[model samples]
Target chain A: MAIVTPGKRPGERVANSKVLGKRFTRAKKVGHASLMLTSLVDMFSIIVIFLLMNFSANGEILYMTKDIKLPSAQHGGQLERAPVISVSADSVTFDGKQIATTEDLQKGDVLNVPELEDVLREERRRYEQIHVNDPEHPFKGLVNVQADRKIPFKVIKRVMFSCNQSGFGNISFAALAKTAGEGKPLAAN
Target chain B: MAGAAAQPAGKGGKKALDAELNLVPFIDLLSCCIAFLLITAVWTQIAGLQVASSGGPPDQQQKLENTIDVKLMLTDKGYALTMAGANIDIPKISRDGAQNFDRKTLSEKLKTLKASLPEQGSITVQPEDAVAYEDLVNAVDTCMGEQLRNVTVAPMN
Candidate 1:
């Protein structure tokens, strides 16, 4: 009932062969594709190990503002986590909150600033309240101070005096650790 | 049919599946962890110089009272070494050129002081308003190098 044209059959065969050849080429390319995952995995493993070592040895992490630049010291132990009193060139801040300015602290030969005292008193009271139930852990009264290297010692002393009056007996000055031979003359002399 | 029979069933099939570990996601996670850890490593090196602003522990206070309290005043001239109880003063050695304190003389003096009073473990460094922080740190390092481990800072009014 159906009549097939000879010319049409040959053309159909040619098109089918072209499609089959294209499919074969694509299959070959895929077979040759290789992913070098072994080397990548090894490199990542080494990096992970190195990072973990550094993380474990890290001590107390203090959140210091950008305004203060801590002086470098060649000898000192790790810092302990405690309340921070930052003394920048322009302002004095307690835990990132500005309590007074350098001019206010150095004004009129004042050894202690009233505003800093009040803040430290409040901080002490809060700390006492939190540890009141734990008899074993009495209030250690340790404070960490981050003062800018440029700020005069006069401002720092007033802050320290305020902290002492507020019942903090132990004060720690935060400093950047100097690498060996970086500041050798200072230490040697 | 013959080729299918020739292929080992259990060992070869299991080996192919086991070799694939879906490492792309694992590698991505490891990379992120490494980056985060590397950033925080810098914070770990920051240290603290401890000072007893007020009275220390009872045992420490008793020991501290027996020993002499030495105070080093850093002025524009030089360092004024004073003994609280003995009432002794070491005259300031004027600055060498632009340098504030004669650190070499200061170190030698501190070394001599330590030799005489081996019991002395602490010294209070009081810097004037104009003294640079670097000079203060240098003074402190000198004190520490002389084995004065307990260094406290006070301001000279």
Candidate 2:
């Protein structure tokens, strides 16, 4: 048997009654905020995944040439944007400046090696500033050569030698997407 | 009186505690990423080239009325002629015959084929794997040398 307090009955205590309605209950306002945050986390995760997939897929679509034929290379190299030098059968041009031709580079022809080397060096400096400061940037040292099929290997060798002297090592050749019909032999101009 | 006192205590503290972990922000983020991925996946598959090798059957619609299938196999010596998979030996051209990429003979062969072709002449050059690059280049050059421009390089199957 338990003894009851003589001061007040447990169910009829006046102190509990006095404090009852005075205390305030906080409202469930966080409902909207929780829903908002849940959506945010979901959105960020999907973005991270999408970015990862996109960076990889970008590798294939990046280096395809629509207009020129690329010489087959024995050395496999990654395709990246490089300083483009377009060589037609008749002449060689760097950034639209016609530098030389078969006639201009023949034996006893005065070839401007120093001038060619200077231009390549300028390109290298420009590219380095744009692509090297940030570690994540992928456009490192690369040079794209768009040489015509008929351009003699001797002419290309000279250009390549100049490129090496300019301290730019990476190289890529541009080729036309194979098509039906007798493909045009690279013009010899 | 006792029930009235306990009611406010039970409701007041619990409401505030339930408000802490809001999920609204997280759901907003997920909606954006899903939309981005959907767009990218659709963009991945666009224009691409289809490559076909020579030695395969010519296109049915492109074939002339009576097409002659001349199979020229690149040998150590020179070109050997075949038709419908059977070898046809020409005189003075032995298995160990002239190994030089004889420009004269090659140009003559191309000229004959060019004359016999229907409106458009098509010759397929199938070179053996062991043939030197120079010889292959020479063979192609000779075909073109005779002004037989419609040619395709087909590897032997």
Candidate 3:
């Protein structure tokens, strides 16, 4: 009934115990190592890819306005340094000063000619002075406009026209940089 | 797998190995990142006139041509069209009629200015801070109507 030869029992029992111990230990180690490796590799690869893609786009400072929330457009790239100008929904600011209010800035708003002229004159004089000092150098200045994304094109045209008169030939609008974040906006500079 | 096959050879009954798979969490993370990149990529293309500068002796001579700049200042009251650096007088629209464009007078004035200019002349439109949107468009339309197509909305220098 025992199914074991009477003299072989002790030797067989010792051999089986040793073999089972070795096999169990090896299986435990392999399972732990492989599970850890899979996850560690997965996390690292994603991080590296996201960072590389983010920095490759254009180098531009984004101007955010309180009044305008620009809907994201599909076009993404880096823009060179031009003059930076920011227009809040109701006001325009350049070089850290309020240039015009919505009533002053909106194309539909009543035009205030003298004040607009004064601002343009001031901006132009500043640029001209900078260019005059370095005549040999091609001025790479651009007017970087940050306005409410929802404001109409007419307002943009008026702003552009004013800048053009002030002698800023280059203008660019600031957009949020493309990254692995949507509905969440990156901070604008 | 080899160990499991070898288990059946023992005197004891065959053992069982259990494994489960549900990859939902990993899939969720990847999808989030992909969605973010896709949505933010839309606003990337920039639109502006490319800067073109041709370097040569001829370009220098072209630059030397006496070009008069006409500045059209737009205000809420109306437009103050100026040229040769002198402020041009424009009659005010009554406050009640502030939004209306006196098209006939505007067109006539712009036409006269165009008639006096030579070919390839340029004008800088300077819209003031308080200019009405309709008025600015009217002014631009008027300038185009008068055949001054080489228009630049430049800031005052």
Candidate 4:
């Protein structure tokens, strides 16, 4: 059914015709969807800021293994790149290769570990050979030692001795930097 | 939001000045940044405690030998601060299985040593064979905290 109504003003019929034409044109674009991305953008922006704040420019070289747990330290400095000697609960490793067994190091009464010394000497020679010409960056004998907190000091003493005997005297002990929220580890351990 | 240049009326008014800002590409860029940052994030800081091994290469010697040599011995009991022909012992706190007596006695001894002898900057830590490795680290850390930076790890004499 259709009802006819007369226009009250002179231009009312023209405006009505123009509105009907626009409505007909808008009907063809109804399939397109506009997603409300305001909330998603807000969430992603926050995530980006949080991640950027925690990003580290210099990457860590030491591969933390499941067998070793480093002790936390309230005062620790930046770790310069050097040869790493990892002493876990069961074995001692140089870089990624196994050097000696824990039992052998524990039982031996000598001040220095013979196997560790040999490896360290070879490493020192390699470093010296590579830097033979460059006088500015001579071998500093710096080495980083990563050891489990529960290992006995006897093993550490021998390792230290071996490092010293092989000219790797500038030893640095690798540890986790302590934060404020974490409770102190057993002080006597 | 346009106020100064007003529209005449509704029928024949000026064109709308509002423009749409497309957020699809912006969100895409944010997503990529978040992924990259998360991949390179460092959860825990791995640091190092430096201790130049004494008796190293013989060239490190020939420093001032007259300064007081502070020797800290770490055993199962606690810390033993020995220097200048005097020994002060710090035993474990009673019944506190995990509490260290560092704050009680050793702190005072170390403070007095620091105040009395401002010149001594190094301390040799001698840990017995049975002592746990963490205790040695803690001992060295305590010494460093007390302004003794040049720490050395040596076996018990």
Candidate 5:
């Protein structure tokens, strides 16, 4: 058996004295701003899930520029740590160093780039000396080329020619990774 | 950061009991996680398409002999696939005269070529001076998707 007593609810309750009533009345609307954490938590959780999906452990990703917009590809391998040669409409740079100008390369009929070859040769030598005995990370002769999508193939041909000349025979073109099913499926015979 | 709420216990109740898991620390941790992931997230996955020789030291690439030289040539007009002294032209089909070569036809031709030469997995891409880099990349991508992994880019003479 329980005994019930008549009590004042929150709405029906009155302040004890004049000062208390004034204080309560003033604090009611001032401190009543409650945060809607449900929606905030929901949005943060969604963003966290999306970011986790796109997170990559490969820290040394390509240092891309606004000038070079890479082409998208469906089939490709993960980028290896190699010397990158970025070619834009204005100039050709290797490992952030300006090796040659695009206009000069286009004007000249020579396929081989002497300046770029020198730099790559030095890099290849250094790599060989460092990894001579270590079989784990042998010299793979890999190099990355980041070029603009709209640039002419003539500039790329020279860059590749120079890369091959400098013993970096394995040339990998940096491309934006695209989903597989975005394009129509073509049979691989 | 945890406490049980006092509620009337009943065998049959009008409202279903719902436990509100409102933790300030949990929200704080979630915010931290979201910040960390957002800061370190790689929005666009930049990958690599290997399109050249395994030859190293002196640059004298081995001539791919005893194999049909499957060369896909990209020109200003269209794409021309050359194999063993024969040229199969696959014209670009676009209303605005853009470089839109028929990928399906090219795939069929490559399938036929691959069936004939199963051992040869390498291809040489020859691009003209006026050809765009994106077009060349797309051509190489198609070849690689068709299991021709070893693609060597060469300047068209």
Candidate 6:
């Protein structure tokens, strides 16, 4: 037999039980309000791993200035960490310091550049000093050249000649890597 | 945690260790690491082509003299391939309206030269004043493609 209160009808008793059951279920759901941190952490882990792989594969990074635009080459190898000489259409800089203008560098038919030679000689001396203490770190006389694509080969030759004269015999030309099937010819300016 | 500590020991007398993990600081550290890695990532790859400017070791020079001296001169008209004693000229032929050296012919010629003189590893590339830098690099690329690694750029007067 259903026990009913004196003021309530039998139907009202059933309705009350149903309402209490719904409230119990709603109260049980309130405990499940947890943040899905595991999925977020999983996503971040993938991104971190991907970025780390790229960082490792990328060898020495060359910080290029705004004045130079390196030409694209299909056969360039990894760049070594060395002194950088940047040549643009208007000016030339060594280690980010402006040393001479394009006109001044190509002033005469003379192959030697005096100002660049002086700067490179100082660099060689500094390297030699560093190598005096550490025999393992001998001076390799390597230099990196970052020239604008529009610059003529004559100016490049002059710069290269100057580098040779300054005792930096090993020269490396900086270029952007070109992927296969790009089909776009390199800009000729 | 205080309420649990105040409770009478059930079963064994040992206190239960707190197992809740603090994720706020851990998430903060991960965020910082991700941001740093993203900021330091290198997008474009920079590469180099090595060339020796002048004098090398005596032994290396002796080895060089044993083989032919290949000189590739970039002229406005075409590429002049001079092999110390042999004279071979490849004129600039236009393909698709752009004046360019005949790369195929040059490559074939270089392959023949490489076959004849296997010890020759260097080639001197001299471009005229009017020649573009890209053209010079392209010529170098062709030379390198044919197994001539030691590419030296000569000064143009």
Scoring only the A-chain of each prediction against the true A-chain gives TM-scores of 0.76, 0.49, 0.52, 0.75, 0.74, 0.74
C-alpha lDDT of all candidate models, in order? 0.72, 0.50, 0.51, 0.79, 0.80, 0.77
DockQ of each: 0.38, 0.04, 0.04, 0.45, 0.43, 0.38
| Best candidate according to TM-score | 4
lDDT of 1 by residue, B1-35 (tens): 12122323456465332223556678788889888
Candidate 1 residue pairs that clash: none
A83-181: candidate 2 lDDT, tens digit per residue = 666666566677768677645554443223566678998987877687776778654345666654545444554565566567644444443333223
Q: What DockQ class does candidate 1 belong to?
A: acceptable
Clashing pairs in 5: none
Which tens-of-lDDT digit does each residue in A41-156 have in candidate 4? 88898898888888878777687899998887767788888999999999999998899988788996888888889999999999999999999999998999999988998888
- Between candidates 1 and 6, name the one with more favorable TM-score: 6
Let me know the DockQ for model 3: 0.04
> Evaluated with lDDT, which candidate comes out highest?
5
The weakest ten consecutive residues by lDDT in model 1 chain A span A21-30
Docking class of 3: incorrect
Compose the digit string of candidate 5's lDDT tens values, residues B92-157. Answer: 876445547677788888989988887778788888998878778788888988888878887788
Chain B TM-score against the true chain B, each candidate: 0.60, 0.47, 0.50, 0.77, 0.74, 0.71
Native RMSD of candidate 4 (Å): 10.0
Ten-residue segment with the worst summed lDDT in candidate 4 chain B? B1-10
Model 4 has a DockQ score of 0.45
Candidates 1 and 4, the one with greater lDDT: 4
Model 1 misplaced stretches (Cα beyond 4 Å):
A1-33, A56-60, A187-189, B1-29, B35-41, B54-60, B64-66, B83-97, B100-105
- Give iRMSD, candidate 6: 3.2
